[model samples]
Target: MPLSIYNTLNRRLEPLRPRDPKRVTFYTCGPTVYDDAHIGNFRSFLAADVLRRFIESPLCELEGSGPGPRSVVHVMNITDVGHMTDDDQADGGGEDKMAVAGRRLLEQKKSGKLPPGVELDPNSPYDIARFYTMRFLDDAKKLGLKVAIEHDKDASLMPRATANVPGMIALIGKLIERGHAYVVGPAGARVVYFHVPSFEGYGALSGNTLDALREGAGGRVGTENQSGKKHPADFLLWKEDSTHIMKWDSPWGAGYPGWHIECSVMSAARLCGSGSVLSPAQLVQMQVPDAQPIIDIHSGGEDNIFPHHECEIAQSCCAFNASHSGPYAGMWFHPRFLFVEGAKMSKSKGNFFTARQLYLPAPEGKGIAPAAIRLELIRTHYRSNANFTEQGLKDSARMVERWRRFMDTAGKGSTSSDAAARGACREAIAAAMHDDLNIAGVLGELNGWLGRVDAPGPEDAELLREIDAVLGVLELEQAKSAQTDIGVFIGCEADPAVLAKLNERVEAKKAKDFARSDAIRNDLAAMGYQIKDVAGGKVEVRRG
Candidate 1:
């Protein structure tokens, strides 16, 4: 079966297609690097990771050609600038989020809360952005979300918003030249706005009419009214202000680009190739040509469906291909929210938690595994809001442990790979994945198959390997060793020192030396070893 997905643009299931049959350009809206990313934010990224895996899998073969690393390019932008708090559509309405975080650090320094030599400048947005960007990427690494990290030559491309400011300025100029944008307000305080009425399909993506969006603007309508906006809903393209330290010199004045422009510009520059040093006439014609789609798929959370994504479509279309009457992205995918304890996560409600918080033991007793976290998130359908609970974590851990044991047992028998066999279980898994990523169904099928296994046959072994290509939660290779630990128990290999202790413990037990054996157990526990007594006067030593 061919791969199909629920495209949010047209609100229907569509067959996957790329402008170039050999390659696919995938773009995902990344996090604003101002704070630690919460679990809710990671949910959307998890969906993107799953989608990329499925797309690159052999099961996604189209006619005869198969998608692979060279065929698919996953681009996730890092919003290190222009993102602001109090912005409904994530456009710059209030203060820059990085600047706000920097101010907090400044306050902390004044209160003497900083570590000795740690100095922070409140005016430097880069300092705050760097701090949280590292945190966010570290969290992504811990959670095993697939993305390019540091200097790794990975499949995904991560471009920063600040790095593409020149491209943003050029795109804004093109918008103004095309009569889709206008400059308003006074000289130094001038702000550029996208004329929403200029684009005929302004609200096509969100299905909100221009007049309806303007009517619902409420207090925000008059907020920019003093800026001389032609319409209440005209979103900001650039804001000219000298007080801001993050300002850049633009045609309009020395100011910063708006929040919506960042995504549009970055994606265009990275994926579609915006000319860096082209003349004004040359730049105007340097839009994404209609020969191929600029982006094959654009993925984000459901919250970005309106104004944020809608604005992207308008800005991209007006700046590049104003005559084209289609959405900027060929397909759109918006994963639903991830609720905690059946409620929307909020710090005020004491339910909001980061991936780091979720990685540790919640109540200080049972620790949550990162693999378990990955499993629980993937078990639910992406379109549905998955409710995260402690019980869910426990269940995932148990299931993962069971699968590991099965693979370990299977590993002892079959050491050969079946080069041409496609097992029934593997086929079912692929079919489920092909059908809009029914990962819940995939898990159900795999779990049911695993439960009936006393020992995996050759087919079962091959199936396990094949399934893991998409579901990367399994640790089969580690489980292959005889003394391999499956879950909380760590495995230990027999060494001279370990054998000496094991023999001593056995001798102590035979001599009815309970005190000596207990002392030995405590000593082993201190050294990260757990001793388990077994049948035939033998003992199992596992690393903790």
Candidate 2:
């Protein structure tokens, strides 16, 4: 009953082997901070969240029935700089995503679109980055990202790429001294490239050989960045660009680190570190040095498998332990892409959706609650593509409401469910989760169990609490104001005063104080609130 997962490195499903049972170090790529994260991007992050939740859960059955990882040292990086649009190359091609943000913000500023008191200097990419970074964090919180929730309390959990320039420069210098990287061009416009061919296991993760990359396989090995590279696949580590909007002083020149370098440096510094310095060279070392795994797992979208992650492997291997032949980390996980309405999401197609665009209630009375949005994004298996549609979102809302009612009902019960039945249900849910996060399977188990139970008991509530600890979609305390979008009517929390009165009425009914319940109803009517009891535990709160 050991937890198993598909490691993208060797293309094999294997057991999770964390060197330490107390603390499991995990890292996942965060938003680029140039724009709002689209639905597709969140699907990838949701996979990472689920993985962390399962890894830290006691339900994760491990080898010899030993105690599992007690805690997860999760680090998700905020790419406020150095990420490019065309990320397939080692030295990322195309425009800097932050620069694009700066330009857009400048235009908005000139048009007076930016709000007052929000003094945004479009010329300053740093200002633009912070703006979008905060917005992204807001969205991540609404979607229940644990790292995002604890980010304010622990800044180390989410490191910004711009803040780690020194670390990037240090790692690049190590690569150069180790002969894995070389500097080229003039002092005012110098460039550093990782000698991709120097690392023998360059294509072990992505299966893209140097031979194929040289021939422009998949058009990933771009001809634009061939000026100073030892090989076509030799990705850029540093580029001198004092003229750029966001430039940094580095060993190579006054420029910025490449997109691929940030993940390597941040992952090493944050996950396995010494406060301000990495004197012992943390996770830059081989996978397991003397039976110690500095970093456990790294994850991202499937699109990152290429030059982004591949180059990370080559550069980190060369910079940390030049002779070691292993992937950057011991394990790698990637989630599949997300589509909208059976097609790739595109603005022109009117199917694209940012997290906020769907989570916030719209003027047309169409919107998915935050928890429902989180549910929809993570309900499917990570390996499968989730096709988002309005119907699907509405279904998620109903599902959330259903779970809320179930939990509420369970809380009122004084007895326990059959012990064997409860154990079987928990086992089934855990088994589904251990199978590489079979979200669909786990949810199916939940629905089937809920349907069969006539009277939910105290044990059911405990079971739900355990399940929800991993799947954070159930906001048990939130009885959302019963929006008209979902087809069913249900009792929900309204204004504070109304909710308190309703609670009083429900309590009075439980105590058989019919007179008090009737008086509360009369009081609600006097307050211009129409209260009607519907069958099947649904109460309508129609405002007069």
Candidate 3:
């Protein structure tokens, strides 16, 4: 049987079918790096990672996502700028998230909780974004996210939003040319709004019609924001914000792109390929209509279904489709919300926990094992609301420890071939996993296998290892150090080689060679290092 998952758009189980059966294009809405990604964010990520791993696993070789060394082209974005402070803001009504992060980081530094040196500029939003981006990646490593493990190996797999503004600008321009978007207000302060009525079925994904949308109106916009919009339902493509720390040069003005726009562009750019959003004039020529959505699969948290994902459908179909052939992706996979201790998990409530806080040693709390954290985040069905609690973590820890001991006894060299038995067992788990990612069923099946008295002989142990690859719950003790990419972590001095690159960049800046300077800066940023210009021809470089 083919792999099937719950498609949120159609509210049904759909077979995993891609444009190219041999190669699948997958995209996930990754975290906005304003602060540490709390466990709720990771819950969604780990669930998606399960799907991704299954797509590339041997279970898929016969009838699923197709099997090869590079069959699934998975891309999870790194959102470092222009995220909304409120989810209702399709037009970026509140302050930019990066701007908020800069201030919040400084406050944390004052509170003596956050990690940043005294010399680090509290005003530099880039510094804060880089600092947290590295931390999030580190947390991901400890949890065994394969994409995070291979982040440095393939630059194309993880595209950063700040690094893709040019593509965003190009996509917005395409919208204007197609009559789906228009600019308003004065030249410098102009805001580009997607003309909602121009696109039919604007609210089909989220179940809000244009009339209802007008009543709800996405967000409570200020007089300034409300003044320029063509219709109440029309959302922002770009906004003019001179004070935003993360503004960029665009056709409309020097400002930030809206929260909704980033996912549409970033997803299309990577999954549909980079040429999908290159240059304004060439966009029409690059991607022709009738090909429908160039992406095969798109996944995110259930909260993203509103103005964010709905707006993505409008803008993406308008910009990338000549006719509305399909949604931006063939299938939409959304995991339900994660609750904490019977309440909605929120930082304001003091229940919010990062993966690090749960797994790494800290004074305020005892740490759980990294493997347990991974298991706790993903053991529940993706379609169900999974409540996070201390008891749940403890339960997860016990299970992980049991598996570790079982593997020690079972995971060893063997001569016997249990290929038929192993294949049958994997088929059972894969069937459950593919049935809307019924993860609980998979674990139940695993537990059943574990109960056998003579279980995990050499061949059975090999099969368990194969199953664990998809589960991603094994071998966390061997996780890479948090500072794998960075030569030196944040709050530490830069090494000699990084210093040399910094000096080279400074020299390039002195010579007014902006392209070279920008290239050097981006190269360093990709290596998890960020630079801040210091006084008198000097620079500060920190990595984490």
Top TM-score prediction, candidate number = 2
Supply candidate 2's per-residue lDDT for 231. Answer: 80
| lDDT agreement of model 2 with the native | 0.77
Once fitted onto the true fold, the runs of candidate 2 whose alpha carbons sit more than 4 angstroms away are 82-94, 107-117, 215-225, 274-294, 363-366, 476-544
lDDT of 1 by residue, 284-341 (tens): 5766654345678899999999878998888888777736345688889999999998
Give all candidates' CA lDDT scores.
Answer: 0.72, 0.77, 0.74
Against the true structure, candidate 3 has what lDDT? 0.74
User: Can you write out model 2's per-residue Cα lDDT over 171-216, one digit (the tens) per residue?
Assistant: 8887887788899898898988888878888888888878766666
Models 1 onward score TM values of 0.81, 0.84, 0.81
List the pairs of residues colliding in candidate 2: 91-236
* Model 3 quality (TM-score): 0.81
Residue pairs in candidate 1 whose N, alpha carbon or C atoms collide under 3 angstroms:
490-543
The candidate 2 region of ten consecutive residues with least summed lDDT is 484-493
Error of 3 at 361 (Å): 1.2
